[model samples]
Target: MTLADPAQITPLAKAPAQAAPGAKQRDVRLDFFRGIAMFIILFAHTPGNFFTSWIPARWGFSDATEIFVFCSGMASAIAFGRAYDTAGWRLGTARVSFRVWQVYWAHIGLFFAVATLLAAIDMTGAYDKVYIGTLNLWKFFVDPGPQLVGLLTLTYVPNYFDILPMYMVVLAMMPLIMALSRVHLGLVAVFIVGVWVFAQRRLLAEFGLADLHLGLPAEPWSDRKWFFNPFGWQLIFFSGFAFMRGWLPKPPVTPMLIGLALALVLINVPLSNIGVREFGFDWARDWRIANTIWITKSDFGLLRYVHFLALAYLCWVAAGDKGVRLLATGTGLLARIWQQALAIILKVGQQSLAVFIVSMFTARVSGFVMDNIGRDTWTVVGVNLAGMCVLVLTAYCAGWYKSQPWRKKVAQ
Candidate 1:
């Protein structure tokens, strides 16, 4: 049955007064996909795990990063967009600002937490591994003053802490983008693309500003650049936002379109495979790197964008109403199992911010384990599964906290 229709029958009763239409109901599809992406991201981030080789990035240009960020933008649009629509621009701006602050502080907290953990490990001197390589802990010890200042200013982000800073930048710009989109969506699109093009050309780096140096004794503290440039990545984010907002036209699903998308996927499958190149197709590797599209992850290259869009399109076509129905109200044994699985995933997705923060810590710990201990197949699998369970538990706790009686009473 579709969303509009109920599969189960109910007793008829006197009609009640219709409630006024308000904001759109939450879309579980987004949450479900995002939750899956979270799992993929956790697996992908676990350093030295053989599983990383099997993540989507190995077979395609876009990976969990693209999905996570794009979904974040879509979720942001749902939240901030509704705020802008119901309240005034000022309220929406305030909301965005609040989120930016939260993300900024979260990034800082995560940075310190990871650094302290790695520093503790380093002090033991039992691992015989470089902590600086993983956590950038050396700078924190040598130049705490400047490093702290830079961290506060978002000028010096460690490796894993980079994404949140980029997210903060995007959130900061949401108010302006929302305003422009209201006036002219095409204008907003043009501006997003323009910034992306500028980033891809490395204009900021060309001007010697990409690595903004702070006056610090340590090399890491002195020079910094975001791994994922917000300027270029914003295009992907806004594309998701625009699509969610119905500001962009959807392509009609047709045989030709499906064929083209399939062809794109097939092409990328080989191109992304290093083994294919090692086994006598060395020219394919050279051509892909030197290709016009560039396919670089740092700048969110055109091919990456196209690859994500294509994958999304194919998923949409393949799933359609049946998928929605299954998630909504399917009841066979397998369907029931899937529904239960989706519930766990949905919880994780709903508490995504909390889950993401916890996942990063888990990833670091997992990395340490892999680096210091065994990395055999079973060990890797066990660690990954345990980490995922921790993430899911984090989500459950977050959800439970949100649903506390006192919290509800206070809100009421």
Candidate 2:
């Protein structure tokens, strides 16, 4: 099914005005999904190493780069599309541009904040390994020799895990992305494949190339420098955008995607345990079922894309069902709070940059405090949970503040 242009998409415009008079009735599910994605991101990035043993080979959901990136893209499409409908591309572009700046500045602020905090830790002579991670910040500006040329190009630098830089690149290409999203989803698919292929060979390792490795790093500072590379990661982003654009109409709750995901896991598990020593193709070592279906939590793998797509379909079906909606509404205070908090969710989500920075700092603080006390599994989980709660609460409160008409008037 061919989707109409953003200017033509009318579901949002056609929404009943009683509950949300001016703005469209916000998609509660998007906010819920984003909240879930943020939790995954927090879990993946926090270094207490809770899931290290259980997940074994696969990095924990904390490394859920694909889910986060895909959600980001989908949110962008929905957001900008709504703006385009109400206003025009000029207005929409301006709004999005401001949002980009918001994210960029938030990233910059967090960098300095982390740097100062780390320097303090270093001066105090604490956590030497963590301190070592701090020293790599120079790579962001200087591009430390050959190990980081990918950082300069914003590609596949190994250690950087932030997605801000990658989002910036994607945002720069947004107009083109939106345009192509309309008439050429197939081309987008091909482009993603090409980038993924090039990434494996490190072809984009150069300064001007795709630079797929820039954000694959595990350290804190260098990880910030490379972040995630949009070049290789764009497939996941665009795939989400394509879904929102209605390019590939999602078939609801189908067995195909789920079955494919399972098959991938089944095939890759045995191969993974055998190790490269057993398999003649050393390349098979990285060939997990997740990779087959885009299960990559860290990078833009193939299995993750499939899994996320499948999940989206499932969510859509569930939410569209009357019984599901009734159940959600009946689920008591927490569910009701989340439902009424749609405005809050969108506000914090829009300010994702701030939320991320604050959350990271909260995590760091938790880590610092907890490290002084203990390093057990419960400690790690507690620290992470505390940070996550603080972040969410702060975001929700900020959103509530923003939603106040008095505050809006004052700002205006």
Q: Give the Å error, residue 11, model 1.
A: 26
Candidate that would win on TM-score: 1
Clash counts per candidate, in order, are 0, 32
lDDT of 2: 0.53
Write candidate 1's Cα lDDT for 221-305 as tens digits: 3544576778778888887777666676567889999999988887887778543533556777787757634587766788999
For each candidate, what TM-score against the reference?
0.86, 0.68
Tens digit of per-residue lDDT, candidate 2, span 259-320: 65446444544454334444464566556542433343344555445544544555566676
User: Model 2 — which ten-residue stretch has the worst lDDT?
Assistant: 1-10
Quickly count the clashes in candidate 2: 32
What is the Cα-based lDDT of residue 177 in candidate 1? 93
